[model samples]
Target: MIPLLASLLLVTTRPAVSQVILVEKAYEYVQKKEFGKAREAIDLAAANESTALDARTWYLRGYIYKELYKANPATGGELRAAALEYLGKSAQLDTSLAYRKDGQAVTRYLVVTFYNEASGDLNRQAFDKALTGFRNYLQARSGEPPDNAYATALYYAGYTSLLMGNQSGARQYYEQALRLNYRNSSLYSDLTSIYEAAGQDSLAAGTIRAGRQQFPGDTVLRITEINLLLSQKNYRRVEAIVEEYLALYPANVEVMLVAGTVYERISQGDSLSRESYFNKRKEIYRRVLSTYPDNFSANYNLGITLYNRAVDLIKAQQYDLDIVLLYEILEKVSGLFREAKPYVEKAYRLSPGNLNAMRALEGIYYNLNEKEKSRQIRATINEMK
Candidate 1:
């Protein structure tokens, strides 16, 4: 009777001991490289309420799955998630030295995996995925010493978000990197774009100025700043900014182009003296042309500006003028057309088949009494397929 009763007690105790026994068996299976059985054993160990809170159970679970994740990150799926979660939990519980070491190793592998995935996504132009992957790498190794790749990762994270059309996300990630003192010139250039797109004109201007402070010789940011100021109709400030840059970088084609654009914007607005702004825009383009003789934009914009100025001047002449006076006014206006002709002609030479350049040349040649040239320009325009 006593022996039978003892056997019954042992049978009831089996369920109670099942959790740790399964966990130990999981370790055994892992040693034998039988991950399938290891997973089964760990799953059962975690399923039991009594073992659920035990540190060793979670540690063993983490260890088994960490190996699985490291085996193939792309195929890790729920196993990867399970490993990261239980490993994090084990570390949090201060399980043991072995558990902590395994957790760190898993995290290190995760860092490497995510970094590679981020770079791969970047190569494929899968920007949103790249951004997330880069961020995941940082999260994996939060307390580790940052390498040069840290800034590169952050910059790409921002760039990828920008590509995904998430301006706010780009700004957030870029700003984090900037705060960490990342020293790339494009950092400022890109941040300005985000701020400008968001309609934060002041912020955009500030970003450009800040970039200029860090990289004083970078005229791209300087031009962007001047353009932003122009958009706000800050004409004097635009003049000042452009002049400052020109003094520092004499005959710079890009800065000169931006300066011309600034005055062009000012000339179109009512706040400034249109005549002065018009002349300034012309002068700036002329300066650009002197350095870059075959520059298409300078020639085209200068021609357009002269044509518009003549139109404005002619319209301002009153109908009260006598026939001879009107004739004389038309003759004087023909001089403006003459001045604009060579610029439009040069633009046409630079871009042989450009439709806008062709159209502008036709108008200039027609107004200047070169009917044959005008006809030829129109024929070329018509030949465009």
Candidate 2:
């Protein structure tokens, strides 16, 4: 009679003991990052109704699956699906617990994470997958997302459509994003390129013009406008733009370079005498030097200007003047040469077989009558060949 009663008590407590023990073990395994063991224990606890349906327990399952999905994304589709399932269950268990009133920030954060995961798929050119992920998030959300969220999602969707060669789809999405007050300069730039590619130059220009008004200080947009003018051979307009900007920002090196380049282009276009052209070139270089004494562009342009002057003097049988100008250039521009050498060497280091820098060095050495140094450089060039 005593043995029979003891057996009955053991049978009655077995289920309760198993449920508690499995849940405790699962928690311990999760703490240790032993995901496989944790998953196994959780599965066992989940099968037992007494432990499986707890809201916190389901939430932990979701968190674990989300982490696993992140660790190995290629094989994580099912895991992420499982996470969504468990999280949904948790929310169903307690609607108020899905997002806290005081910590509504966490909800926004999760929304952003969902968006980021979708965007990652977009970046990988998995347009269908990205769209599916985004749609899933939209469907799951109780209300409409904020303006920025809508804009970002639309922009990425447009960009992906563009990549997939669906210009109309891209345009639709871009318009949607724009409607949401999305004012991204890069998106505008991309749209301009797309319009231009489709042979809609007028639309491209108009888009860029609109973008310029929105982003008034964007130098890239200005440069884009300048390039457009150049491509159309509107030299006078480019010159006017340069002159206007130069008047506004006289000390800006980039503006100075642009102005100098415009002047050089004008000089080149005129089929004038070499002397007249060289004189104009000299004036441009002098103006550059006046503004930026130690500027790389100014110094380099000065060296080229002096070199041209020396060449003209030599052609006119003025050897003494030619030698004097060459000497002055070497003395005044030696620092420029040293400063530029590192950048040129870096290019050569990246592409060791490239002869452009070596050839430039050879010319400089040859001009200086350093035949032995030129020969050494030539030997390295030959080895590369």
Candidate 3:
């Protein structure tokens, strides 16, 4: 019983006395301006089990570190980070509220220091350093009241993370900033890109949906969600989503373009009713051309749609045996080519170097018996080669 009591007493008293001595040594080193030695002593005291749980020990350690941070003329970040970290610990562990104001002051100083650093680094385009600085500022002020600056800093962290090719980190920072209601519409697009790049299609779609809710009528996200559905080959779902968007924005060029492309894809793929699919494609681009007359894609697509219909009609005539019916079909096929001529010509005029439009124009002019126009288009196409 005597041995056990002595061992327990030694275990209790040794660390207690050591902590007191270490604290005294830390203060002495500070008075001598030996901050490195002071840091060492306080770090050992901080690690000792007896002193580790004591708020007073952490408080003194924090105060000493703060002084060391101030004494250093170097912009070496380690000392300031250590000061804020220890002070935060001291403040958190101090249930009596003692030293709370001092801890708060140290945290504020760290925040301001980092904020200035981040601003300068950003101006210099030192993205990694800027991100770290903003992150440090936010972390120092964590658990404090958040404001606009805090939210903007979070977004900058995510933006830098993205630029540095850290998609997962970018996602985390963006999600946090969004939860705080950071109002940047481009955030959704970039975050969606990150998730989509990682093959997280469901999460990408969900992010677009959430961003749409936060920023109503954002066409980029709407288009993104539609493209996501299209990528999955969920044509019916894509159609439904595209229709929903078109209802909201009837004159939306991008949505119309996507819708036209989707229908054209199905027509070229496995659709049973190719005529109806082609008709849908033609109608969408026609509406787009009516609204945006010089629209390159719409003009080109409408021309191609008409050209394909004419080709289908000619192919049908070859499958027939009746001479009179073949003649009538041939006449209609020529008329279809004539109908396609203007749109293809418009497309080529709007975008002079477009190979597809030139090719279509060459085909239309040749089929319509305009040898000179066809020859000129063929020479231009050869030059492109």
**Candidate number achieving the greatest lDDT relative to the actual structure:** 3
Give the lDDT of residue 196 in candidate 3.
82
lDDT of 3 by residue, 65-150 (tens): 77776776255467776776787788778999987887777668767888788878887889888888888888867877888788
Report how far off residue 351 is in candidate 1 (Å).
8.4
Tell me the tens digit of each residue's lDDT in model 2 across 32-94: 988888888877777788876676567667666766776787677788778767766665665
> What stretches of model 2 exceed 4 Å from their correct place?
1-42, 45-60, 63-82, 88-146, 149-180, 190-200, 272-297, 301-385
The TM-score obtained by model 1 is 0.66
TM per candidate comes to 0.66, 0.54, 0.57
Least accurate stretch of 10 residues (summed lDDT) in model 3?
A: 68-77
Per-residue CA lDDT of model 1 for 172-248, tens digit only, reads: 97898888788988889999988888899878888888898999878777777776777677887888888888888
Candidate 1 regions with alpha-carbon error over 4 angstroms: 1-79, 119-124, 134-159, 168-211, 265-296, 320-385
Ranking by TM-score: 1, 3, 2
| Candidate 2 collision pairs | none
TM-score: the better of candidates 2 and 3: 3
**What are the Cα lDDT values of the candidates?**
0.82, 0.67, 0.83
**Candidate 2 whole-model C-alpha lDDT, 0 to 1:** 0.67
What root-mean-square deviation over C-alphas does model 1 reach? Answer: 5.7
